[model samples]
Target: MSKQFASAGDMAEKQTSFTEIGDGLWAFTAEGDPNSGVIIGDDSVMVVEAQATPRLARKVIDCVRGVTDKPITHLALTHYHAVRVLGASAYGAPQIIMSEPARAMVAERGKEDWESEFDRFPRLFQGHEEIPGLTWPTTTFKGRMSVYLGRRRVDIMQLGRAHTAGDAVIYVPDANAMFTGDIVEDRSACYCGDGHFHDWPATLERVRRFDLDAIAPGRGGALQGAEAVNRALDSTADFLRSTYRPAARVALRGGSLKEAWDAVRAECDPKFADYAIYEHCLPFNVARAYDEALDIDTPRIWTAARDKAMWDALQGG
Candidate 1:
């Protein structure tokens, strides 16, 4: 309780950018906040990753309006994180989608996640009061599903579990572009609270196989061109390895969580000190890594009280 979450005091507004990564494909990114993607189809539009709240979602909607007047017919949520799906109501899209596991997570811990995330970062939840309740997917798929916005085909698939158990990536074949939710971060730290560390690299490899020309990642700017996309993938992989190795070492050696924290910081700081959300994500990442190292396959749900207890335990050292 003595040390507040790194994001708790992050009240400064971030400059927003709407960049077109592919033909009719856009990425809406704030300085280091959560990001959203847009896919303008032949007739209608498909939006990827709703913002944290209605007011936040309105910003993406405004950006969408600037480019096309097409109605958003489908909203695809990559995962069940509150920051990513709580604002779904703003879209009012007739069909909202998520992976089956993601919806299951929503049923399991959606409220806890919403309360936990809101307490951790107030800036993202600007209009928290406007959020009716937990966002539910009108439709869900087990491994993969394809939706057509007229001629454009969006392949939403659960390649593997990385950021969450049911992470889905939106791949548009026409543009050879992919919208990777938190699975791929460009110059931003991956929030690994509910992540699967061992499964992440393999999932990322599944993404790399596409050899995408462009990508709208979960955070940071839009990745255009093959090189930038690959660089982000490599760096994200490196970040995950860097974070996990030290924590795993500590946990396997019967060291305390505090020791794991220090070890992880020692390894990650020099490399990712300036990355967006690096500090905010470290403790949770370390805790999860420690758990994963101890053979815990599933990530523990993060309630607000658990967040505080984890923070306090690490700070106690």
Candidate 2:
């Protein structure tokens, strides 16, 4: 299998798909693109992971309106990703929430991430000019926060570091469902550019502790049933291990960055070739994994110039 890349034109014309995961809960997906989750409580609504821009977020708003007329009261960011949180302003929710660590990451490297991601995937950043700026959390919690939507309860918890140091998940015990940000991608490749690989598996263990019947992963279709949920979790773990182990091996051998990337690509591309965004994510994933294996604690910031330089160096100019 060969990895398929989405051109900017293809993303521009793509249509988002919204599917009901549970009663009053919807998953807004777009052909393995960025995903958003919606939870409609008795009195109001809570949107999880705003899209890339306000214009894009409006499409999700329209989907929620199709089912309920309740006002959006909160916007929840699963992590500090430009493609995921930049569209938060469109929600107009009084409360925008995130983990404390996530807020810190936004404050530290948010600007560089915005420029890096926009350059990497221009299609997702349509109407990039409409963005007010980096999405800041008006409300932040350290460990966990539980909010009631009338009778419905949504628990947002920072399980551990996975996709990023500030990764979080939204768990609904009533529905036995969990909305895992990028912590666990179903059919899509996990973007581990800023990830903590060693901590990721442990984070997955925390996520599995919940008796979840279904999962709204950050990308791809929602996982339904115990079998499918297990499969998603297993696949995500496998992806991390396969990519990190090989990259780690190459780095330990004192190989060049190109050699490490080739090692990861040889190992992962063969197995995850059919997964969405496999090619787009590999370079960054290998770079971070290489750094981590060499005892680099914090991932380096990815500016637009750095992104092009890395891509050209690895994939050829």
Candidate 3:
């Protein structure tokens, strides 16, 4: 099955849904697509993760307007993914926040990632021209930063290297809620293209230690209650374990990329077949897993050319 390239599809036109996770806290979810979180303070608001473009971010702005009139004061980047951070200018947030590692990754590979992602998932980059440029964090922290939302508190912590070197989570102790970037997902495909699979499970375990009543995952609906939170964590861990183990085994045996891909498919497809973006993520996921299992510590840079080449090799050019 040779991989086929299709022209970028139309941008999603559906209205994003905003669900209140707690008092003064909201989650903006669009279908099972990328999600953004909102925290309203006494004086202003902070938006976590800008969508792909200002046009898309304005939709989120509209959602925030429906809730309150407080101006947006902060824009946080969970990581330096093009889809998550490029639309930041839309908020006109004075302080853009991110972990120090995330900022470094942006400085290192942000441009390549921007070009690569736009090619791979153009639909997500609606109003691409609206992107002022790659987003840079005005404020960067080493481990954790406590942000005060008036009296309420939001703790942004860089727990571990999982989804990317700079992955961070926003925890609200008052609300007993956590907003995990791609670090945790509920019934959504894990994009392991730039992930650390072995470390991701342990990182997730760290996240499990939190006493969360609810969670707004990077993708999917807002999980309500402890049971939903646990399910999300367990499912995310399971997805990583299942995909990485088989892919690593085959790669260690000196199997070809296609063989590794087939091995992973046989192991994961039965369970994750119905999950979002499962097919879309498999090739890149297997490639990274294969590399890591061979003791490749860092994820290889993914450019648009490499994406197609890898797809062709694994799927039969």
Best by lDDT: 1
lDDT of 1 by residue, 1-317 (tens): 33998898899999999999888999999988999999999999999988899999999999999999999999999999999998999988559999999999999999999999999989988879999999999999999999999989999999999999999999999899999999999889999989999999999999999999999899988898889999999999999999999999999999999999999999999999999988899999999999999999989999999999999999897
RMSD to true structure for each model, in Å: 1.0, 2.3, 1.5
Error of 3 at 241 (Å): 0.6
lDDT of 3 by residue, 131-214 (tens): 879899999999999888678788999999999989999988888888899999888889999999989999999989986888
Q: What TM-score, computed on C-alpha atoms, does each candidate reach?
A: 0.99, 0.95, 0.96
Count of backbone collisions within predicted model 3: 0
lDDT of 2 by residue, 1-317 (tens): 12222333355466678888888888998878889999999999999999999988999999999999998998889999999999998988559999999999999999999988887787888798899899999999989999888999999999999999998899888888889999999889999989999999999988887868889999989888888898989999999999999999989998878888878888887789899887778888998999999999888888988877776677551
- Using TM-score as the measure, which candidate wins? 1
Question: For residue 243, what is the lDDT in candidate 2?
Answer: 93
Task: Order the numbered candidates by TM-score, best leading.
Answer: 1, 3, 2
Local accuracy by lDDT, each model: 0.94, 0.88, 0.88
* TM-score, cand. 2: 0.95
List clash counts for every candidate, in order: 0, 0, 0
lDDT of 1: 0.94
